[model samples]
Target: MIDNIRENNAFEADATRDEDTMENKFLTFHLGQEDYGIEIRHVTEIIGVQKITDVPDMPDYIKGVINLRGKVIPVMDVRARFKLPPRAYDDRTCIIVVQYNGTAVGLVVDEVSEVANIARDQIEPPPRTSRGKSSRFFSGMGKMGDEVKILLDVERLLYDEERLSAGLVDQA
Candidate 1:
């Protein structure tokens, strides 16, 4: 019984350590003046703002599809998706490719920041208010030094019902 108890404790410790490592790593990015982050595990790659073929009848935020190395992937303008004012794509603008539910999507942001190790203790739950269209996008708020980073939930961001309305998902 003693040996069995010791083995169980050791397994639990290892599992806790693994979760801690994953919880602290995030890929930070920018939209306008605000900073945002998403779990690094969800990010596949980052690419420059390339030529996007516009798909009619979709939401404005769904900019269009891009041929990423022969694979056609849909792209979304983070600013427009959040109901922010539109801005011209400049040199700093880039796309962050994230995979959710086996599908890859490009998120267009003002610029890519850096990968940050924000501890779980530094993150706070988002406010419970229906303030803006963008509010639903943030999973949590992380405080880093004197700044705050809005942490995004990639699954919610990609698979929201709005995506279905945009014709990205077929109704069953």
Candidate 2:
């Protein structure tokens, strides 16, 4: 009975450690000159920017769709989504594919940085007075050294009610 109790205690300790680790893990990427991060759990894959077929009647940010492994996935330009000026896609441009609401969506970012483990204490809630399309996209800010990574809320960024008003949901 004592051995079983010890094993159970060890299992609980490991589980707690794993949960803590997961909470801090994020996949950091770049959009323009700023760094952003999304929880690692939402990231499905990262692929090079490929040919995106333009779809009409959609928002400018919605660059259109890409054929990814026999699946058509909608791609959004992170810069345009934030109302930033457009820049030509270069070698560093990448598509970070994420699964939100059971649908695969591709986010076009300037480049992918690296996975960062930002402790919970380092994250601050989004500023209440910040107003704009981009402001609603961030869930929090994570501090790493002197840099701040805008942590994106994947659901809010991709599947929010604003997307419905933009006519992306009905067309998709």
Candidate 3:
């Protein structure tokens, strides 16, 4: 599977190399009513509700792992990770699959909104300080038709070295 993807580097390289595709648009989604947007490039596809197999000793936000075809990927509850109130998942709920740092992850979100082409100018710096352990999760904020969308910093969102690995020490 990974080999096929690497083989397709020609197409992927073009997007990265081409100035036209360098700054492509992103698909924004909601967690706790707040809007957030990530580069569409990272997004694979949004999947519907699926059975989650709980893994022991992970952060509260790390719901569990799911078998997507053949690969076992971790799924994170965006709301829980951000310390927001838990909400019930419905038909509109989705798991946004993204390729981050070469690994595929599914971020559980409340609902996905529309796709907007927000230019570079529209993204403003995120507040210097936010009510969280790590403000680095968000790269900045973007405004669209009076609505504020938090532009996430995918790299930072994963935090650091030790936390990157899914083999977390059992919190049990």
Q: Each prediction's TM-score against the native?
A: 0.81, 0.81, 0.81
Model 3: CA > 4 A from native: 1-19, 22-24, 160-172
Query: lDDT scores for all predictions?
Result: 0.89, 0.89, 0.81
Report the poorest 10 consecutive residues by lDDT, candidate 2. 163-172
Score residue 72 of candidate 3 by CA lDDT: 97
Error of 1 at 62 (Å): 0.4
Question: What are the per-residue Cα lDDT tens digits for candidate 3 across 92-134?
Answer: 9999998987999899999999776888899889887545644
Worst 10 residues of 3 by lDDT: 163-172
Clash pairs, model 1 backbone: none
Among these predicted structures, which one has the highest TM-score?
A: 1
**Model 3: how far is 108 from its true place, Å?**
0.2
* Model 1: lDDT to the true structure: 0.89
Write out the backbone clash pairs for model 3: none
Residues 103-171 of candidate 1: C-alpha lDDT, one tens digit per residue: 999999999999999988999998877567577777899999999999998866877776767886434
